[model samples]
Target: MERILLQLSYNGADFQGFQIQNEGRTVQYELERILKRMHKDFIRIHPSSRTDKGVHALMQYVHFDTTLSLPTNKWQHAFNSALPDDIYINEVTKINADFHSRYDCVGKAYRYKVYKAPHRDVLKRGIETHITETLDTRKMNEAAQYFIGTHDFTSFCSAKTEIENKERTMYKFEVIETDTGYEFFVIGSGFLYNMVRIMVHFLMDVGRGKRQGSEIPAIIAASDRTKAGKTAPAEGLYLEKIYLSPEELTQDIPKGTTITLKPTRRQLTQQS
Candidate 1:
């Protein structure tokens, strides 16, 4: 058996979520279905991260063990042939059996987009959240700085999450103003359930003059979910990228390999 790693992107509007559920459609279900067809047997794929329903992925990674020995380039073509147009397999590589797509990831980056307008952009609906109120980007950026570094994010996670440890390191958090709206880029060692969405909500609150930027520290110290703003919509979230250690990344893919995929037209408009 050989371990294989694949990089892919998917538009999440049509699926329930990344993981397979008993009833609804899912990205994992479609992927595994295609893999079963290729191998003529059951195959399971482990993803780098789990995204909520309507959360898109720009560069998602997955790994699985397979007995088939197809060339790396052909693997992409074969998988793309069966997968839906919204999902595309960009690259594939052979990897060591010990490498894991999730546990081995050292860091990840996520992006949340918000469009400020009196009315929703019909073209970008369901991909970018629309806010009728004007947002102060400067104040949002100031609030975002407080989220950098390590902290117990209990106040910023969903109440439905069962994880006990809420400590995670925030390597970078910045709010960039775009022509149409704002883009929140967050990089972290790890994140709790709905952590990014809650952060975005709080930042938006700060931008709307409903909260003070200086209150972030005290809110985080509360360790209560009620202290944070409401969770943002899942449609605004995107799994921007996943980072692996130099050693782990080099073990499979060659040096200078570019894993970034070109953003689709919808993604481009959202960023704009």
Candidate 2:
């Protein structure tokens, strides 16, 4: 058997989530179902990250082992032909048995889009978070800057998260103006569950003049969930990219202010 890695993107509006559940349709379930039909046996896949319901992905990675005769170059076409239109396989390659989609990931980039205007863009209804109020992107940018560098993100994560270690490094957090309004881009070594969504909500509050941009440091230090506002809705969030190597992580993220993301905790422990 050989290991295959597939890079994919999906419109998650109709998906229950990335992971499979007892009920409801899911991205994993669809991919696995197609694979089972092709291989005539189940082929388990490990994903780089799990996105919540109504979220989207521009670039996501998954790896699986198979004994099938599919060549590396043709894997993408084969998978794309079988996958639903909402889910597309962008690329595929063969990798070493030691390579892992999740554990080997060094960094990830996520973007949250907002469409602020008097009139709604019906075309982008489920694609962006729409708000009718004027927003101060400058203030949002100022607040986002405070998130740069390593910190305990207990206050920024969902209370439902079970991860024991709350510390993660934020390489860069930027607010860039787009045609639709603004997109909040975050590059990090890793993130706690709902961390980006939570931070975006706090930044939105700052943009609305409900809070000061200068308060972010104190809020982060508090380690209190109440300090951060409610999680931003998932429809605006997109998994922009996944970086498996330190070099790959450094080259991407346009207009990034920070230099490098710290290695994952597992990498640090292994080195020690």
Alpha-carbon lDDT, every model: 0.84, 0.85
For candidate 1, write residues 63-163 as lDDT tens digits.
89999888887888889988989899887878877777886676688999998899888988779999988899899998898987789999999988898
Give TM-scores for every candidate, taking all chains together and pairing residue i with residue i: 0.89, 0.92
Whose lDDT is greatest here? 2
Count of backbone collisions in candidate 2? 0
Residue-by-residue lDDT tens digits, candidate 2, 24-69: 8899999999889988999899999998888999999998999886
**88: Cα error in model 1, Å:** 0.8
Candidate 1 ranges with C-alpha deviation above 4 Å: 246-272
In terms of lDDT, model 1 sits at 0.84
Instruction: Give Cα distance to truth, residue 121, candidate 2, Å.
Output: 2.8
Off by over 4 Å in 2: 253-272
